[model samples]
Every structure is written in C-alpha cells, then in structure tokens.
Target: MSSPPAVPVTLAEIARLAGVGRAAVSNWRRRHSTFPPRIGGTDVSPHFSLADVEEWLRSNKKLGKATSREWLWPRFEALGDRNETGLAIAVVGRLLAAGEGDDGGPDDVGSGAVRAAVELGQREGPSDILTFLLRRWLDTYVRQITTTPEPLADLMADLALWVRESIEGEPREDVVTVLDPACGVGHLLAAAATAVPAALNRPAALLGCDRDPVLTALSDVRLALLPRPGTLPPMPVIASGDSLRADPLIGTQADMVLCNPPSNERDWGYEDLATDARWVHGMPPRTEPELAWVQHCLARLRPGGSAVLLLPPTVAARKAGRRIRGSLLRTGALRAVVALPPGAAAPHSVSLHLWVLRRSVAGETPSGPEELLLVDAAARFPRSETRENGPEWSELGAFIRSVVGASGGRAAGGARNGATAEDADTTAWATVVPVIDLLDDEVDLTPGRHIMSAPGHAGPRLTDSWNEVRELLDGLQTERARLAALDLTSGAADQPNATVGELLRAGALSLRSGRHPTEAVAPEPQHARIPLLTLSDLLLDGSPSGWTNPDDAVVAEPGDVVVVGIAREFSAWVHEGPPMAVGPQVHVLRADPQVLDHWFLAGSLKAPANARHAGTHASSSSRIDVRRLQVRRLSLPEQQHYSEVFRHLAAFERLVERLGIVARKLGQDLGDELAAGRLAHGK
Candidate 1:
C-alpha cells in the first residue's frame, strides 16, 4: 500500500486549509460528489485523509493559499491524541535527523502518522518541520497543561540575554552558555537561542532540565529546532531529572540563567536535599518553594554571570523568605526587583516580580553606595485591558528595557542624585534604594514602596491650575452662548424612518466589521505610531487611545459614522481626524454622502428612540446590536440643516467637558495648597 496517506484531518481542518467556512465544505461535499469521503472520526466530526482532501481541493480549484503551519497541524492531529502526539513527532524528528530521508516511510515508523511527516522532513529540513509542529503544540496544548503563559517565555528570554551582556561586558569572542533549570517546553531556552545571535552577535549553547519526562522530550525537540550559527560550545543539552537534587549537568556552569520555575510545591525534594550545595545563600524555609528554585538558578551561574527569575510577589517579603532576600541583597547578588502588572504572566490575576541577580564577582561589595534598583511597573498594563486579554507585548517590552537601562547605570558604576517628583519627567520611573534601607526589620522588596514616596503630581502650583481653570471657563461661556443661538426645535417636516437593517438592505449605508487581511499585532504607545480608536476613546475623548499597525485595523473615513458597540452609554461620532483603525468594540457605518449627512445620522443614532433599540445592558462590555438601530430619513436639505446644528452642539459639549476637567483639577490643587498652608486664610 502507498503509506496509507499519513495525515488525518477533519472537516473543520479541511475548511481551514481551503480558507473557507465549514458550511462551504459541507456544501462542496453535498453538491460535488467528487469531494473526499470521511475516513475516520465520529459522525459529528468526521475525519478525512489529508492527502485526499488536498487532492480534492486542488481538483475543485481551492487548495493553494494556506500558510505552511496550517497545512502541517492537521497532519500532527492525525498522528495520535495529545498525550502520545509529542512522542510520535519526536520519533519522526529522530528518523530525519538520522538521515533516513523519507526512505523507510510507514515501514520504518510502523504507522500512518509518520508518512506525511517524513515527506515534510524531506521538503523543509527536519529542524524546521519540528519548529512548526512545536509551535502548534504550544499554542494548542501548553496553556491547558502548564501555568506559564506563552508571552512570559519571550519576556524572560529578553531579560536574560540583556543581563548576560551587562555582566559579561562587550566585545567577546567566546561562545556564551545560557541555562534554564525549570524549562517547560523550552520557551526561555528557545528565546535565549534566538536572542544570543540577534543581540551579542555570537552563538549560544542552550542547557535545560525538567523533572517531567514528557517536558524534557518536548524541550529536547524544541532546542534542536533552534537555528545555529557558526560552531559554538557543544550541541544544545536538555536533561530529564530534578535539577535541584541530582543535576544532570552539575559540573557545567552557564554564563546566564533564565527560568520560570513552578512554585508552591510542598514536596519538592525538601526532605532529601536539606543541605544541598546550591543553598549557599541560605537554607530556604520549607514553605518557600520558589526560594529553592531561586537558589538552584543562582548556583548554576558562573561568577559575575546574571540570572533573571520570575517569582511570585510573596517571595520578596514572605516571613520565611526574608532572610534569603536580605542575604541576596547584602551580597549584591540581587540587583533589582521589578513588580510587573498582574496580567503579565499566567495565573493572570497575580502580579509577579522579576528578580535580576548577579553571582558575586571576586572582591565586589554592595555595602553603602550600591543601591538596588526598584521599579514600580504594577501600573504598566494598558488601561484598555479586558478580562480575557492580558498586558500588551510592546508595553511589556518597553518596561523590560526601562528596568534593564535603570539597573545598567548602577552595574557600570555610574551614580546619580535622587530625583524628586518635580524632576520625575526627566528621569526613568525606577528608583535606586540603598541596600542599607532594605535590610530593615521586614526586608520588604515591593517596588512601589521603596521607589519615590510621593505621587507624580506632588509639586504643581495652585496658581497654574487656577489659570487653566480660568481659561477653560472662558471657552465654556463662549460655547454656551453659541449653543443658545442655534434654532433648537425639531422641524415640522414629513419624513420616512427606517431601521439600520433597512438602510443596509436599501444600499444607502454599508456596515463593515471583522478583522482586515493585513492586521498585525498592535504597537505600543510612547512611540510615534498610528492611533487605533477603541470604544473607550469614542466614549471619552474624540481622539485615538492606542496604537496599531495601519494594516491590521480597518480605517474610518471622513464621512463614516462610528458607533460604540459596548458601553453603558451609547455614542456615535463622525470621523473628522486623519485615517485611524477601528478597535474591537467599534463598528463603522459608511453613509452615502449624496443621500444622508454623517452628522445627522450620528445625532439620530444618539437619540433616545434609536439608543433604546441599539441594546441596553447592566454590564457595559455586552455588545450592542448596531444593525438593529433605527434612523430617521429626511430630505437632503433638512439633513444638512440638522447636521450643521448638531456640529455646533457637539463642539459646545466638548468645551464643557474640558471645563469640567479643569474645574476638578482646580479643586484638587486648591485643597492641596490650603493643606500645605501656602495660601493660609487668603494671606
């Protein structure tokens, strides 16, 4: 037989490969008798042979547009279930690595799973094929099986590579080795492999160890997939065993260590390894499992090498871990404590800390002048965060850079004076707290407390606030007069009214929603980038609130009526700004300029009748039924008049909002000045 066409696929997979919907695939099966029949699987989700589906798609003119990963995932799904899938993939990788070259095929592996996989190896080297397979595995199965979020792996890798350079200094010829003792699926290890070449212009030897055998096998395959430069320190080594108890790579020391070890495990070999050599900092209390992992990471690093460990916030000030924290700081091993936002990692509700550590180089002491960097990045997450999505990647990248830059100054022996709240804008958000201050009774390492005792607005004068309030009041009075002058009553004119669905059907307006073809990951703010208009931006300010790739989002044209689809209060705006993309919670209604005025449609949509029909909910996050909204149809002349009046009223409302902000700030400043006795009893 011809290898049984190894890759098995489902109807849904067929649709994805063909870049169409499942219904279309069903239609094809019913209408075209030539379509492939189900080979396996339940009645609800029937499976088909991958090769047959592709052939069918080709014969029917539909098989040439999918990404390589999309084409490979179904093949892996056909191999076996999730548990044995990784092993089956490992076997195929081993076969290709051994130079079998797809010769043995199903005869060599004794299964249908290896047939297409061997062909894949023949086409795109075994390493590349394995990388694609591993990524699919991680995206689909890793989160449900592991606690570490995928993004955190990238962050830890970046921090580790950055610290390695800081510790080793520049212009090196030797290959650097990076290790991850608790490497889960080798995320940090993969990151390190990529970062070493991109940052330091050198090859890297990646070392990883995990107690779980399956993870070890998975990590080994992933490490083999990493791209290699010119010859480095031996091939990437991943060992399976408890890294803390009997380290498989004990004699070897890595130049940098990066890890996200499991925490809160009670039986993490504490009884058998009480006096292990790794606990040179202090004997970790039995309750603090994270400290044990911390010591293991520190012990694996060579002298002057840096290690960045992601730990729970409790490790910084826990009663049991306090002694180790103080010891690490006193010896200058602990360089910085960065408090990340809650959603930065998995277990998404807990805000974790990144502890930047350096093994004690000979003759280095952090007695008095060596201040530890403490960064308050707890508020670093984007304000537009939802319960489902965590922090933004670009923002997290910026935070990591800021933390590294702040600590880099200290590591290079560059000391500077303390910055008050007045000079905060000129300096980074991090503060350098002396080691002596941290060696207090509690040994607290929370970033918010040690960094800057005062809030950002500590020094602005009441006079300045009052002047702004005065200016805003003047503008508001003028706008109020303008609002009063407009003819305010609805005209007694006969007109037909229609729902938004009717207008859509009549071709008077086109409603467009869903992602654009060229959409990409959004860029971070604080950089010069195109603004993406979110629902919050629509409801609060008339401007954009976030950044996105111009291609990844749909742009709002000048005449388009934008509606907020998820909010306690409904809002609609006519886009008058430069081209901006619509965010997730927004819908764009492009009106025919010849038939309707954009401003008039928006005003009518905002009215009580239309707003009530749009959708009402106790939770603002509930989506609005924008298509069900009603609009009043009027003569073009009447619409133009109403549009003109609505434009003036909107401008007036904006001025009033500005006036409110100024009034609130003036009240706050007045209270602060009075409390400080700066204007006691009006002098």
Candidate 2:
C-alpha cells in the first residue's frame, strides 16, 4: 500500500534542502567536491540521500568543521540522487551547512553567517549593490532599528512602532487604519505590519505617504518583499507627494496618524496654505520644521485618532517659537515630549524630542487635565552610540507599549521582548516627570540632561555587568590620579625617546608574548585580547601606544616598557594613565625615576625637528605609533632634555581634567532630575 517515501527529489527540492541556490548545486558537480551524490533534476540534476548528509553535517558543526564546495559536495554526487520535501527551512539547513567549513570563519548561526548563506543565493546571479542591499535588509529584518528615539527621526520611528504594536494589546475593531504622512521609506509601516500581525485578529491597516518619489517607490517594493512568500499581500497603495500641498489620499480619515516630517526644508509651500484647516492648534513659524508635519498628520486623522511626531528641542523653549509650541501643549493634544540623545541623526548631532498628539474636539476628552508621558531612553541604551540598536528597540518599545496602557484594551501590559519590569529593576529607575517640570526648565528636553543615572537597572538583574563597569571606572580614576601626580613631579619634558631594549634595561619596557608556540597566535576573525593603541592618548608629548583601549589587556603595568620600533621620549613624564595595555603598534615603556623624571621627558617631544624625525621612522600617523618608536639622536643627555620640557605638559593635563569634570557634572545633574520624575509632574 503506502510504501517507502519517494526516492530522488527535484533539483529545486535539492537546492531547497541544501539552503543553497540552484546554481550552487550545479557548482557542486562542476567543482566535483565531496557532496552527497544523488541524481535527478532538470538536466541531470544530482542529489544526495537525506540520511547520509544530516549525520555528516551534525558531526562537522561540532568540530572546527570548515568545508568548501570542493570538500563536501562530491559526497552528494556519489550517492544516488534523492528525496525529501516539505515547507520547512530546517530540511535545507543541513545540506547547505554540509560543506561549509573550508571558509575558515565560524559557521556559527548569526547575522554574519546569515549574510553568508544569503550570499550564495546570488552565486550565479545578481549585482553587488543589490546583494549589498539584500544583506543589509536581512540584517534589518533581524533587528528592530531602535526604540529610543533621540534624533527627530528616531523619536518619530519609535512612536510609529509603538502604536502599530499597541493595537493587538487591545482588541480594537479591525477597521481602524493608521497613517504616516511624511514616511521615509516605509520603516514605520513595515514595523507596524510586523507588530500587528493579521493573526492578532485586529491588523494594523498600515498606510504611509512621502513626498520623495524615490523613497516612496522603494517603500512600495519593500512592503511587497516579505521574508517568507505568500504570507500577506504587499501593503496597500502608499501615496507619494507633499501631503501638505496636495491631498493625495483625499477624504481619507485615518484612525491613527504617525509622522516624523522634515525639521527644516526651506521651501514648504507655506504661503499657499495660510488658511489650512489642519492648523487648528497653531500655525508654523518660518523656523519650525515640525509645525507643518504636525498640522498635516492631525488633519489626516479622524476624531479620537492619535498622532505622534518628533519636534526639535528648540520648539519647546525657544521664546519666539514658544507661542505655537506652548499653545499646542496647553491644548492638551500634545500628550508627551520625550527627549532623545543629541547625536541621534546625521549632519547634526543635537538632542531632539517626541511629541505625542491626540485628536479630540475642544470639549470632549479624557478625565485628567492635559498630561504628558516623557521617556528618557537616552541613558538607558548604549551610551557611545548615536542611535540605539536591536536590544534598545526592544527595551524602549516595552516602555511605550506598557505606558500607553493599551487603552483600546488595558493598562499595565506585558513587556515587548523577554524583559519584565523585574528583569533589570527598571521600573524603579523609571521617572514619570510632568510637563511642568520641562516647562519649569523652559523645556530644555535633552534626555541625557534630564534623566538621572539611577542606583540600579529596572527589572532584570545585571549584577555582573554593573560590577564590571564599576571596576572599569575605578581603574580610570586611579590612573587619572597617578598621571596627575607625575605631571607635578617629573613635569613634561623629563622623558626622552628610547627603544624598547633601552626601556627594558632601564626598567621601563618589557616584551611579553607566547614564547613556546608563536603559531598559537594564529588570527581569529576577532583579534587577540591585547589592545592596539595610538598617540592620541598623549598630545604635545610624543604619545605611546598600547597604553589603554577597550580591547587592550594590561599585561605590562605602568613601568613596563612596551618595546616597539625605537626608544625616545624616555624623559617625558607618564602623562598618560597607568597600568594601560600597549598595542603591537606601540611598545609600552616603563621608566626608572632615578635615571629620569617623566615630567622632564614630556617636554622633549616638543622639539619639532626631533618630533618629525621620530615620526618618520616610527610610522606614526596623526597619532604616534609607539611600536614605531626608534632610538634617534641619543647623543644628547636624555634626562636633561626631559627636565626642560616637563612643566608645559603638566599644565595641559590638569586643564583637560578640569574641563572634563565640569562637563560631566552638568550632564549628571540633568540626568538626575529626569530619572526622579520630579521633572515629569502634572502639566
């Protein structure tokens, strides 16, 4: 009756099984490598038995199994071509990974690997840029751009993703449509689509319109290109054109409006729309880029619709622009102004704010006086980054979704990702300051400035990371002090340049590397833990390398000389911090106080002629390469030169420290106020 499963699958099925493109399968035979060999497909298509390959791949993944098309494919060719087909991606993963070891890089399942797997899809086809874009899109799909909206664009996207996802929390009527008038490439629309999956029973009927034809065209295509085929239809007609000037989607009343319009597009057709109906709250001043988008988004939405847009910080407190901004806030339609990080955008890195707006008739609204929900994610995510990443998006999204309370449903909803209020103890750090707090400070809505660094994380526990950061900070502080003391003791010019051997003889340099097996240091995709340094650590004085950097491990302490190219500036004081790691680029130099004071050496690098001469030999760029340091004119008494130049270096170091402290204090004060929620009190 039933019988065994059919034997050889089609070439297409083979390709699918391998997770490789059809051509990749063809290449396997051409390469004549050890891939499983089953035969069957259009034009003598070859295949392998499923049982044979799956076992082999599992074994390979466990070991350092690097494979090549040459190494693994022929195995398939040897076996009788054959079978297995289903709607699952797992079937193909095994065959695809079967011959993947020879590349040498890890076959680890990750974004990089994902990119590599997709790279094969174009083995026998496609252009580079398209491939580039494809890989980037795949990366983007795996990630949520960010939840923390710092720049005007960031805030806008955040509000958009938030509202789109919020629909499922409350089972609203499936008919409500959401629109983003000034959409740039449909980022918001796509995010909305994902957040409100059709399975939720209430799909977000996502729509958007942008003035830029190019951006709009791309959005149309992107909406169509779902990761998996045949799931949902491409998004409905997303209009292209200036929404303010032309009514492209005329007579359409959207249930929700999300827009992050251009902040400063000089010519906005302002003169033509003086009597625009959307300007119910306030008209746009020549300077305010947010005003036009604000009115346009509002006009597009029906009564009770919600519109969230990001505005410049200047709008909140700028005296001249205050009338419009103030009036809107007073109107209560301005639900929130969440401040963001300064470097959140390109061209300019300035703090921005998000303004959440609700559409309601003058008299009919919720119970409380107009209130605002301010979130300062600026401090919650990666501090050094201009824009937040995936984890940040997930975290920030949770805040907005939970805070809004999913009114079409209930308040206190669950966190977006795996996070909970208890995950990092974040709820304790969450500050719900009032609009008046912002107004009191004249609305200086800088998230970093307002949100204070709390004692601990919110919900999840991060004890290990917290402790590590504390240790790092302590090290920096200790190093700073040692450098300061040396500045006063050795002055700047006490150090003179010298080679690693000289520093070693004088107890300033030491060489450390694996002695027995140099081969043990074979390059991993990521470099060794040893840090690479540059001369940027020292200014004026010839800088040493391998002193301090994130990746650097301090194997050699302060006094140990990192021998690089040459020895010079031996007399310069240890102006740089202590116990720093040296890069191969720079040899760490440990100095003997009895032989030469570091202060005196600090000034010796200033001799322009010597500086240039040393740099030429050392291969230093804008910053010096300590490894390049070589023994130049050692004829001069090094200590004498070091002593001469010490004072100037010390003065510079002290001044920098003072300036840093002041800047930090100002930032900390603002963060403190925002975190306490004192700034977020009633409007």
Best by lDDT: 1
**Tens digit per residue, CA lDDT, model 1, 422-509:** 3223133577788888888899998867654243343554567667777767877877787787774766556667888898899888
Give per-residue lDDT, candidate 2, residue 9. Answer: 43
lDDT: worst 10-residue window of model 1: 411-420
Off by over 4 Å in 2: 1-171, 198-200, 227-234, 342-348, 361-363, 366-368, 379-683
How would you encode candidate 2's per-residue C-alpha lDDT over 1-683 as one tens digit per residue? 23322234444444545556556656755675565566444454344554455544455442223333222222222322121111011112322333332233333223223333334423522222222333223222222122222223333544543444443333355555768776655666655555445323345666778776645654554554433223443345678888878968867787667666676775787788788788876667766657777777877877556677656676666655555655555655666566554434321234556677766654454432344555665555433433221124445545544444332132223344333444432333234455555555354444444544454432122444344446545655655665556544444444455753455565643435311111111111111223223333333323322212222133445434343332343223343443444433444444555654544433443334444455554433333434333443243366555454445445555556544644454455545555666454576
C-alpha root-mean-square deviation, candidate 2: 15.1
Worst 10 residues of 2 by lDDT: 518-527
Clashes of 1: 1
Per-candidate local distance difference test: 0.70, 0.47
Report the alpha-carbon TM-score of model 1 versus the true structure. 0.65
